[model samples]
Target: MGYMPTEMELIELGQNINMNLGGRVDFEDFVELMAPKLLAETAGMIGVKELKDAFKEFDMDGDGEITTEELRQAMNKLMGEHMSRREIDAIVKEADDNGDGTVDFEEFVRMMSR
Candidate 1:
């Protein structure tokens, strides 16, 4: 197996993607705001279809609206393959506000929202 990645690995990977996106947000809106970064992050690892597929988890009420937990699960699923459980936990804990032992949807969206 390949060597496990460190905390800096994920952080650095995200930073790299942000840099590769090559511009700042032009709009002040949330959807428009994070569009670029989100696309960039999901480009190689996740994608539009994959996001839509994963979004199912976010629809907590099943009213077609995405919640925070669903979002977190999507992200965890995306990058989880690239890192070890310990590393994933450390990275996730930084964003898990409820301390529920795992990331919830809202907290996840908030983290990505940052």
Candidate 2:
């Protein structure tokens, strides 16, 4: 799915357009006001295939889920950054929606989408 702007984002966009165009916004004006924000948000987004690839990379053992250990190892190998065990645990905890001590594909997607 594409970037879903929040209600607050719409409100702010409207306010910005109003401020710049004196309460009148043509299609061009709206596009001009919205394009930058949309581009910035999408720039950070990975496509489904890319996300799946990333998940696979972290799931090192081909187990279809990413445990804290797997994540830590992936981080160390991929990013070359040695994170602490507590830090790794915290990352898994944040994305483990079912509190299962592991992150499955759906949970990983939800975490990344945020």
Candidate 3:
């Protein structure tokens, strides 16, 4: 891992980014500010095969895409965290670039890589 940022550092970065954006921090703004650091720290840490495996784990029913129900079940089973439908919907919204209401392999890869 390359220089994982401390909590304080992350707070400071978020504050700075928020200030730069006129006190408004949208999702894109947040992602733009943090993506570089995140990419740097995780670069080469995960390979394509691992990503595929992860995607498959979430993509229950071998459907080639992760539906909200699949994600919810996966989270509950794998992480023991019972997430609400709204929470799962928000996650899918963030990762589903195609707006198909599901996370495909490519979208999952992009989300993880980011």
Candidate 4:
């Protein structure tokens, strides 16, 4: 069987993605927004459609947006681990556009498909 990724490796992977996204607001807002660095360490190295579907899954309220709480819960449920509240807030703040305190589909796509 393949080896499991360590927690530090996971955090580094997240940081790499966040960095490559350049803290953008949306994919259509500018060039290279979707040019995010892909990490092979992630589960099966998913594609854009799978990534978007994952984002939709995170939007548990079906509100077309993912709040920090929703992201936190999704992480816990899917990854079987709890993320710190601060980490969740940081992630939301990183992708939040229009300052609405949430990541919309555009932002989510831009962040993930990067």
Ranked candidates (TM-score, high to low): 3, 2, 4, 1
lDDT of 2: 0.82
Best by lDDT: 2
Candidate 3 residues lying further than 4 Å off, grouped into runs, are 1-45
Q: lDDT for each of the candidates?
A: 0.51, 0.82, 0.81, 0.69
The window of 10 residues in a row where model 2 has the poorest summed lDDT is: 35-44
The sequence of per-residue lDDT tens digits that candidate 1 reaches over residues 26-94 is 334334434444545544344446555444554555555443444445556655544455665676677
Identify the runs in model 1 with alpha carbons over 4 angstroms from their true place.
1-80
Ranking 1 against 3 by TM-score, winner: 3
lDDT of 1 at 9: 59
TM-score for each predicted model, relative to the true structure: 0.33, 0.61, 0.61, 0.57
* lDDT (Cα, tens digit) per residue for candidate 3, span 12-111: 8878876798777888877667666665445446765778788889988998999999999999999999999999999999999789999987678668
lDDT: which is higher, 3 or 4? 3
- Candidates sorted by lDDT, descending order? 2, 3, 4, 1
In Å, residue 16's CA in model 1 sits off its true spot by 41
Error at 52, model 3, angstroms: 0.8
- What's each prediction's clash count? 5, 0, 0, 1
Model 1, residue 112: distance off in Å is 0.8
